[model samples]
Target chain A: MLKINGKPADAAGLTVAEYLARENFDARKVAVEINEEIVPKKNFAEVVLRDGDIVEIIGLMGGG
Target chain B: MVTLEDKFTLGGHEFTSRFILGSGKYSMRLIEAAVRDAGAQIITLAVRRANTREHENIIDYIPKGVTLLPNTSGARNASEAVRIARLARELGCGNFVKIEIMRDSKYLLPDNSETVKATEILAKENFIVLPYMYPDLNIARDLVNAGAAAVMPLASPIGSNRGLATRDFIQILIDEIDLPIIVDAGIGRPSQACEVMEMGAAAVMANTALATAGDLPLMAAAFRQAIEAGRKAYLSGLGRVLSRGAAASDPLTGFLHD
Candidate 1:
């Protein structure tokens, strides 16, 4: 199981791009990080998610 | 008469508008109108977990030509703030990050020491770091030494709309700190914004003042005017106040009876 955004997920061996596509997240608007390391946009397709990975997908929001 | 330029520079970028608007606590549709009415060149944003269910993004509502200042709102420490800043930069916007490290949930006060640490790290990475801090002279100086482009001292608690509760301390930072002192948070009314600007604050950032208003765009415009007026007053040199006695504007000898 992978922890994506602090929630346990069953996704394993799925690339970041594939996970994003499966989740309906627009790739252009969001930034992905695995285990506290930023996964650059250019390498999204190559970076695969493994079991026990902690993933955090972030985006711009309204705030002060 | 020699005319000096009336603009403030932050991280080598010159901005003529002294009002910095916060894009929070309101509908995204109103952002464009508020930005236009506020005449803000720089606007603040937050980085958070992207929701796939929500189709709308805040970046979409921001008009063209305005600089984005992504803030680390949820971070509770220096490293957490740094990580958030890095992720925010990867989102394809510019490298401007507002360092807001808060450990407390209720008051939402910034952790000044952690903020300074984050500023140092971010600035070294070439990010334009603007650290929001408690109104303290020592920490402000430390931030300047830590490579912050500008210092943002809060007037009161975040989103409280309490006005300038830290007036005198903010004044101390404005007087001592070399970097631009941008007053942030808890400015409820246009008069409060004007008061800080008159005290020589480089700029003012507000959100709740407009977000809670019945008319956000109109309130934004009011803040813009007040900020400009205060800047002008600062530039023109405000009239001195008498300590004990009142001084009449009209001369005593000018009266017909005299």
Candidate 2:
């Protein structure tokens, strides 16, 4: 029961990379944050998810 | 004769093209074409929560070697803006940022005070902070003092496409502010962009005008030409204005009738 973008998902033991791949996100295009701290790209594969872990993914979008 | 070699430098980064294209309100597929047509070496973008349903990503469309100016558009306060800027850097988009803190819903006005605060914080963090603000000289000075890489004064309200409604106010920033003056927002046409550059603006940022246009690439090209033309004219030094009577371009002695 991990929170990804405020929605609960069963990701108790998934690495950041696994979660991204499972969710069908192109890991190269997004920046991941865990519990208010940004996880740099180099650490995505090693950073593991636990119960109630909050994940926020951000991407470059259209803006003025 | 200001060629592309006369590059504009902001925050220690020299850009060959002064036109900064905004990636907003347009299809991602058109971004490359628009950027190429505008000859923009710097492009601005906004960060948002990744869409869970769609696999589409705008970053994939941006060409390599172009600098990314990620903006804090949705931030309503200084701290929020800071968070957004930091996140953008962590995303590996580099340190260039456009601080836009707008809480006003009606007019969509930038919060200048918050912008200054964000600039002070981010500038110390080594981010090249470019804050958008209303055309006010005092605030512009404050921003410069706060280590802002550049001061962006609006021509009018955000997304209005009204074109330089605050001409005199913007002129003051251009006159006194030592930092680069990039005119942002409310510019409706290529001619308006040209007009501001002619008034000595360092550069211009336009989005709504191109987004709403029927032909985005064509409009981008138009803006590129206009900005170049205006910059050349400003470099050439415009002639003085007269209150009464016309000044003849050719000498009176050279007239055929004489």
Candidate 3:
């Protein structure tokens, strides 16, 4: 069982989409960069995860 | 090519690449592609009142993880630049600013006196100012003296693709000035940027030329390679220029040549 911000995700290995849904986040409004490469917005649903992977999520705010 | 291995810092953010790109042209896809190809850590954005009204169409263009450097491009003076900088801080979440204060549409040369005056005030307010200036070396020194974080001297004129027109003065500014010398404007080609870097400039900023290119992504990649090559050359100390035709490796006239 992999931890989700210190808590384990539900049962099976969760895709980033499933993880975001479970964690109450709108994944589209933010960007996900795992390790270094920025995951394309379209890949969010297809990107499966493993245990102990470090994910950095950055949210974008309104700007000029 | 430059081999100086030069790096510049803005608001504590360090950047190794000497070529900075503007966020004004091409499609969102091209902008994204060019940024990746350019290897630019700093992506400059300007405020437009129209964007606020059309928020949805504009918001999608921003790239992920890029250090959003909001520029005061529309500001007519230092006072306006300061206000715009403050507002951009709220929007960009950063205090770094690119100050452009030319009022006239033709000849986008900055109002040097006002810029120096404004830089002093902005410095007091803790703003990291990078003012775009004319080819004037004295004005460049004055801006630096007035607490400008960095001074950008135009290579020719904004939006004009004449290339590095201020080479001689740019060299002097870079050699004599303590602060970083960033060459801006009039860079029509990547080779020109390489030339600027080779001349000991800390960095170069290009927009119109890249944006107007038929293949902006390709141009950006070319610029990226050129900047790295130039920086490497500068770091290793570029060989001096030879004006006359003929190799004079040894003493040309013994004591007379000396």
Candidate 4:
């Protein structure tokens, strides 16, 4: 019952690390924002996801 | 006279190199070498959503201790640009952003009004907002009033490699606006980069010119040298131009013929 990048997923009561791992995302290369608040990198393992929580994963890409 | 070691500040950050490199359309393997060859202290990058799989990260390719200037390339308006800038900052890359809010897909021209609006918001949020715009003195003034760190005016359409098609308009901005004017897009050659810098631009940012070159590192070095030479010439104070008269290099009375 959580939104990861606008798609609903059952990640309630899961830590950020578990959610990223379940989604097969390399946490080292992505930054996560939980419910419009940027969760610092160090807190990923400790920040637990709640029902209806929105998560955004940002990565670096080519640009000018 | 300003020495090569003389540094300038943008958004309270000091930089010795006037050249800023854009990281796009080039191999990530060459990014570090290109930056080193260019002697650039700052480089720009873009952000996007993660792919949710194992892949190479662009940030890993950048050298240590270099400033990462993230750009809002996909945003079509002010609020979108602001959001992108905030997301980029949350990634631990400092708050230096290149605000590129282009709504015109055909020409890829920045919407000046929206750019000014983005600058006002980001600047208030403590981001070092460097907004790209078409060269206009009044718009440049509005950006300055909005707390922009610098006003980046395109020399031509994005990725066109046309080289300073808007020279007169850019000149007006240089003559009128007080902020650091960085020439951003459509620069094809190193000489073109030199031309704008010599015309009193505070800096030059080149992407396609280097990305499409035969040798990326060598072309980067060429741009670095050209920018240095142009900045030196500008600091030395160029001589006046005469339309109908010729001025001899040597004194008239000191020549052998005299």
Q: Best-fitting candidate, measured by lDDT?
A: 1
| Residue B99 accuracy (lDDT) in model 2 | 97
Using TM-score as the measure, name the better of candidate 1 and candidate 4: 1
Q: Candidate 4: misplaced stretches above 4 Å?
A: A1-3, A6-13, A34-37, A40-43, A46-54, B250-258
Number of the top-ranking candidate, with TM-score as the measure? 1
- Model 3's alpha-carbon lDDT is 0.72
Per-prediction interface RMSD in Å:
0.6, 1.1, 10.7, 1.5
Residue B147 CA error for candidate 2 (Å)?
A: 1.0
lDDT of 4 by residue, B1-258 (tens): 677577778999889998999899998989999999999989999988887653678888999988999999989999889878888987777989999998889999999999999999999999999999999888999999999999999999989989999998998988889889999999888999898988999899988889999999999999999998888888888889998978889756766665
* TM-score (chain B) of candidate 1: 0.96
Q: Model 3 Cα displacement at A58 (Å)?
A: 23
Ranking by lDDT: 1, 2, 4, 3
Kindly give the stretch of ten consecutive residues in candidate 3 chain B with the minimal lDDT sum. B49-58
Query: Model 1, B95: alpha-carbon shift in Å?
Result: 1.1
For model 1, how does the per-residue alpha-carbon lDDT over B111-151 read when each residue is reduced to its tens digit? 99999999999999999999999999999999999999999
> All models, DockQ values?
0.92, 0.77, 0.03, 0.66
- Candidate 3: misplaced stretches above 4 Å? A1-64, B1-6, B50-60, B241-245, B248-258
Higher-TM-score candidate of 1 and 2: 1
Which CAPRI category fits model 4? medium
- Clash number by candidate, in order: 0, 0, 13, 0
